[model samples]
Target: MAKETLLTYLDEQIEKKLADFDVAIDWDTRNHTIEVIVRLYAENTNHMAIDDREGVRSEEEIIEFEDAILLYDDQKAVFDEDDYLAVIPFAGKKGMQQKVIDALIMYLPEILVKGQDDLLDFLVSDEESIFELHFSPDYFQALQADMTTAKQERFLPYPSY
Candidate 1:
């Protein structure tokens, strides 16, 4: 299949897995590569909104949520923006943490690509299924909203085994 066709397949497969969340995929035809971005989130079901703000939840929960977004390769593991902050505190730097976080966010797409290459190879060999989309923008958006609103609803059902 051509690159675009392959992307469609991957996107559909990812959506199936993330039916409850949002996902976005960017395909770079020039490089014959795809960048997948997913936002995993929970909602704030509390009856009252906090001073017009969304709500609140533990930062640790966010870390756990991101950690659960698994890929076939370890290199493609999901990263939590907050969890990375801990390392900076341990390093005793204030502004340094932001820099580190910025670096990770900037290169996240490339990191995912490394993991996807292996996954694509496996899927091609398997022949049982064809994966389409490489990323979920909606998922990423939800996560972004979650961070911005600081509201917590329900945990995302863990990715299937």
Candidate 2:
């Protein structure tokens, strides 16, 4: 079997899982980090959106709305989070790296099956793992830098799907 970095492996896995959506990925091998951005470039369907008819919110109405929606759901990224690059750093114990890798493998398919998730949480993995998710300017600098990249790939939408 050929060995690959977590980013490389996950990139291939995500490429396959999100075949229906567009994905952009880049990695900084020097930093052992991977950055991914998922774009929902879905074509608008014929179905029109309907309003709930509950307009003009008061504090109580806002609270009720908040109660109804899950803002930080780990199963789906906040609408804005998907627009920004989600960086997953893999550097530490081999076993933990594998675990994080495993999680990433499972995550992309979950998103496809459900079409969304608590995606921002990948920025931090606590005591149970070695990965860390960071959105710092420095990381972005490295990712954007012309010299630090080890691998990058993009998957465009399927022509018919």
What are the C-alpha RMSDs, in order, of all predicted structures?
21.3, 16.4
Clashes of each: 24, 7
- Displacement of the residue 67 alpha carbon in candidate 1, Å: 11
Which residue pairs collide in model 2, if any? 74-118, 75-117, 75-118, 76-117, 76-118, 77-117, 123-133
lDDT of 2: 0.35
Clashes of 2: 7
TM-score of each: 0.25, 0.36
lDDT of 2 at 92: 33
lDDT of model 1 at position 100: 24
lDDT of 1 by residue, 1-161 (tens): 53223334445555655454444665433332244545433332332122211235332312112221221122232344332211111121111122222232433444355435543343335342332223344544444444432222212121211
> How good is model 1 by TM-score?
0.25
Residue 133 displacement (Å), model 2: 16
